[model samples]
Target: MEEEVNNELPLPDIEVNSDVPRGPFALLNRYGNKLKRLSSKGGENSSKSQLLSAMTIMNMAEKVLSQSIHEKRGDVSNLVEAFGSDYADYLKRVVWLLDASEKLTKRQYDEAEELLVLALSGSLEGHPIETVLTFYGKYLQEKIEVERGRIDLERKVEHVDIEQAVMDLKVGVVECEQKLPYSQISNFTGVQTILDSVAAAERIHFIDFGPKFGSYWILVMDALARQGVKQLKISAVFSATDSVEETGNLLTSFAESMNLPFVFKILHLDTWEFKKDHLQLEAGETVAVFMKFCLMPLSDQPNGIGALLRGIKDLNPLILIVIDVEADINALDFAHRFKEALLLTCALFDSLEACLGRGNHYRKIVEKVHFQEVICNGILSEDGGFKRCFKIDLWRKYFAEFGLVEMELSQPSMHQARLMVKGSPSWSCCTLKMNGKSMIIGWNGIPIQFVSAWKFHYPVSPAIDLFILH
Candidate 1:
């Protein structure tokens, strides 16, 4: 049976030319070669190979349609028919997405809406490109609605129940954490860094900038209990709309169950309003700040990220931990942002498919609630919302500008990440690498998320006193 299957889908042996023009034929040929190479190692059923094949077909359909349009040809039927019946449904959907994208670029709202509707009507449920097509189709629909003034983007977005959305998002995140290693890598590395930083301190003051789920702090609290720390205070800062009281209550209960002397403080304010005094800091306590998946929402605000970072600097915590998705989706141009979002989503969906069964309920929830929101807000939101993820290099520059220097993640953190990846057969393809002082968790060679630690760059005069005190 295996031999027959391999024979039916034999790998191609095409010679790819580096100087070939990026026309329809050349693009298709290159992607075909890519598919062949990917499948030769992992077999035809590998998630990466399947995704690459789908992308190749979509690109071929898009290129042909685009070329026909630019040449003033009226009919795409003949061009699409050349791919034959095997890909007819998939090609039709891809062509519709391409057409909708062109219409969106041209500001033809009605045409774009019609094409998006048509593209979304059919079922591509188990297909590799299903999530990508659905996200792009819905994004285009949102764009058309906004463009036609049929809906107010800000008003529509504001009407969503923030608390309920946060709760749903927390559930989705926990689901993903169970099935994949990215979140585990981030949380484990973060907890390890915090413990190493405050190893000698009798009292610990952990300030979390965005404690939407507060799951990471549970790990911190458990670890502190095991280490025999005397007192632990967790000050959770939340945007006014987040479910602050619930998260605090949950953490307080967990801390009590562990018999850890815990103090929970809540600070509800905008990120720009963060200040040292707001934390109600006490003397003789080691301080650490955790910003997990929080800063990206402020990327669209005018100097909002800088202001927040400056505020954190003023607090001068012993260590600051940041864990965020790695992507370059902050471009100003709509088309550029769209392309970046598509690539990111494709990689994400491919990773999910690799790790979870097709009908897994949690996987479906994560894709629908968490990633769908990410795609929509990242592309369609005027304010960038929760999806303005930027690469770690850009984040490093941001920290440097605000007087924070990168602290190399300890060896144990790297080991913890490796153990998590190796523990699960589903996570076999997950890659962990150290980039400079940061640790990156990648999927099939594409960096998906990163974990980095930072500290205030103290001057020589005060460095001695600070070093001695901690």
Candidate 2:
């Protein structure tokens, strides 16, 4: 991302995300400032770190969870005192953000109520905190007071039929096909590269984290079919043991109809875990892993995403395709979480409004089910261990920690995404954003979802090298 330093827009109080444009004069060593704020500093603090975190809510929001470290060390006073009086308000704002976040985490929206108001009016950072917060507050009120979605947020732990939830998600996804185009763009952005890399292999394999009716599987088959791959081996892994037989039948029919040597094996996970034993891989089969909106839900558990990723790393797949709805829905604060969810749902709702008009009752029904499963359940509701989704930067950090290197999502992929947006009806106003490494699907320029590809980075075995030398 380019640092378009516009020193002219003066906002003395606001701080911004590194990629977010800001009003304040560009500080000295602005590059360092960006790096410190974005990195996981792990209780380490410097003059630069203190200044940036103290001055900006985006950085400070991250550090809020670490207040215990300071408290345990009897340095809570240092938080307010260190920045000096001139910037104390900024630090105090950070405190308020932290407090509000805590209240939200405990499911106390009322206590964090003022924080949302502050988020609505305040613009102390580069991120669009105010813009998103404003929408979130309104959205939250509507969800609570009005019965728009089937998944009610007020009811804690309401029993929802698993089959009904699955069907609703399917309905929502079907409606989203022509309207949103996010999944298509994601599939278009990365699947071809994986297919191209594995096309000539005698046998091919797949381990989808959450197949959910085999959408990514369909994309893979299409790409390979175009590559004239006549035979292959395929596997899908899902934590939820739903519709395994039906999914197998669907893929088997596709492979047989295409005259390919393919087998679809389903692992109906007895436990809600990503166990290597469940993969059922055969020797010499090139494996490509698919994780699409599946890992985020598991993030609610401690070490959930990391452990599963480690399992994936152990497998040493030929390619890994990671896709998710791009939003900051995982802020540790209620107001911020709400903002992220609002931004994400706004794009979906807008796309539907533009394409699926109100007169179409079936489309509305589908949209409602989708809104509940994706928006209400996936993002807003505190039940079902729902947690917020992180942005691209955090995901990159997590991938790096797990020894995964980004596979350059091809230029043709970017062009493919761009063409999809351009080729849409002239009335549709969504845009595609490709920041070289990742692609974001946006509505009215606010990014709602992101997609990227990665491969495991294996360190060279020194023992093997020494043996070869001997």
Candidate 3:
């Protein structure tokens, strides 16, 4: 039997928006509602419709999780594997659609759609369904060829090798996370403030400092939806470059799928040039803005950071949420002599200069030699990597002058940061504990929180959030 051709909807142009909620409860409800509706009426067979379903399920399931409830802190330690179990089934469906699109006649197309609707609704599994779909697609393609009086078989491309394609798909998904993972962010100080401010804002203007596809905003969409404001719109400014596209797609799809009462516009402003978006903030428009895990890059290259801040000053967001990352020093200069600490802790580096390029981004760390050493030979210690403790005091001064009253948003101390450390990348595993109520950490024991140099991708702590929020 000949196979059929599958037609899926074209991907949409993606971008960012500012007024998204960072909470998960609301989203859970929304997903539950959608699942109910689909289970009741059966799933859709249209390529785009099925793809959307797959994405929604996958998006909701992105986190490494063991519990579904958020308040149960006891179950926090049982970490679900990075890629949970449901992923395999979802991947299979996606593969079936992609490989079997070339074998369907129109009649078979209709039948295949019905079969797909059924297949997606239940636990039935395997290549049989895929082969059937492939057969249908081939049948349609053959019929079309017959009408045109064409005879060509050798030129046909076979289905993608399932195992290899699945492997590649896993890599693609991981690569997507490599671009930015909420888990990598352990220090979450300003996230809650940003969420609260944005959720409360009557009108909001937002800026995504690095703006990788706006996943952080998706996390916050639920709050934005509940604001109940008759006139609510969020304007987001982002880097206008290819670096921002992939994440932008997820952000856009998420926003569209939720059908929130807000709109988004993604910009391509280069940090080097310090281009700012010409925003139109009206009176009574309450603006709450945040930059996700982008402080390091801006700090290392201050000229661009200065330009971005100058642009930000123009809009004057009511509350500015800055989520900073600790590693990726190429983005900035480390405080408290981190190189000395890295050299002391890591055997690979005989001296601070030698270790700067390893584990740490070699290029940027060595660009300037003003790092302070915190943990000596810590990287080589039986644990994953050395713990280089530092602070973000510089940002405090920069924003303080603007009349922003800062509050420590993190729970303060990460005592026995072992659980948290396990979640970090193998190359960058170290812990920081708070002594007293101070937000500062020591390099070999020096208080440096005032330096404003911590960094991360999302402000949400992965250990705590993975179960319910991811």
Candidate 4:
């Protein structure tokens, strides 16, 4: 039996002849053309094409089955008999995924959950699409669980195993810092700013708020060692829930190895709870503040960030370094937040896919711990969970309102950022650009993270100026 399908001609080459009858074959060709057009744009449009294409195939199959039934064909088998059973099964799964994607885009959680469940029932291993689908499925499931009050029990369990969770988070953050360019850029720029701001100081006191694995301080310690600093004190501030002893020990070991006089102190307080008294500033020591990937969560509390900034200003640090993700998920409606979070996370996942193999352990860890937390908190949390990221512009305005002035990052840091991006073949799509005084690292033209330096606009009194001048 000869099939009416024309596989030889490409979709664009298939002409819609006016003389041809308006049969299923002609309609299929027209729909195929539309699919091609939609798929060319990529991203969400590609998902749309999948939806349209799957629906069109199902519609054609229905028409064929209807015809077969009307003609009294004995034991009419598959409607897509020409493509065989495997193709039919594949089409069904694709349809479910497409339907789920549409539902997620429309914020229809219940329908999306059902469709994703169906799609995931079959084997989808070793495919990028499988990863994407799995992420969405987990997100939807979490949302459903949250609505049913089932996640609260899980949160309690997490708190009970807080040590293990913190360990996992530390591992994930280390993996991210090692694999991705954002942390490297921020750390390098921040270290350079610190060095420049305190060139003449013999003793430096560095205060780190929400320290991540003590990686930034490692860089600072290395730089200060090279600069022949006589003494160094690092105060690592952590939230009450955070396990700080491990990080304190690591920094202490590293500092001893460098033969630098280092004092490590752990302060257990939220960022908003920090005060000048907590720092215990001493005479003849230059103080600098570092906040990396931590400030955004303060938005969850009313005026939390403002309070922190005011406290930091009172400390009169020579320089304040901030490294934060570039996003506008805070203060947005659920629908808008979902859209923005989806776009941001898709780019992040795409970048990860480009850089790491599908089965890489670090990639799995990063996706599970880092990206999943951001996606869920950004979109699913009712009270703007920990990942309430805002853009650099908004952060700039906030700093200015708190009496902090933006400072330009040094040229070497800029050159290092560009060289880092250019040196890696996998990071070819990553880009670096300066937004005013801040340095932005983007993937595929979408800003992912930013690093900026700031200082109090008003200098301290002469009576308190015991440290060496900049």
After TM-score superposition, the amount by which residue 1's alpha carbon in candidate 4 deviates from its true location, in angstroms, is: 42
Residue 21 of model 1 has an lDDT of 28
The number of the candidate with the highest lDDT is 1
Q: Count the clashes in each prediction.
A: 0, 10, 67, 0
Off by over 4 Å in 4: 1-125, 142-176, 211-213, 240-243, 383-387, 458-470
Best model per TM-score? 1
Residues 1-470 of candidate 2: C-alpha lDDT, one tens digit per residue: 11121112122243432232221111111233322332222112211222222113333433543664436323433665654555544545445544554555565666566654543455544322332233344444444333334454556433334445565466554544534456556665566556655756766777766545454465566555655654566666664555656667877788777766777776666223667777777788788887777656665664566667777877788888888867666544454564455446545654454444434345445444444444454335554356556677777766775677887655444544454444445213556656547766665555657787888886422111111111
Report the lDDT of model 1 for residue 391. Answer: 85
Roughly what TM-score does model 2 have, to 2 decimal places?
0.62
Model 1 backbone overlap count: 0
- lDDT for each residue of candidate 1 in 1-470, tens digit (9 for 90 to 100): 00011101111242223332222111122233432333233312334333343445555666667667765333565666776766667777777777777778778877878878767877876775777887687667877778788898776643234446557576655655556657666776787777777878889998887535456577677767877888999887776534677777888899889999999988878767887878877788888888887766675564676667777877768999998888877765565677667666766776677766566556666676546655775567654343476888877765665578899765555554554554455566677766778887776556678899999895312111111111
Give the local distance difference test score of model 3. 0.35
TM-score of each: 0.76, 0.62, 0.40, 0.70
Model 4: lowest-lDDT 10 consecutive positions: 461-470
Order the candidates by TM-score, highest first — what do you get?
Answer: 1, 4, 2, 3
Q: Cα RMSDs of all predictions?
A: 12.4, 15.3, 23.4, 16.9
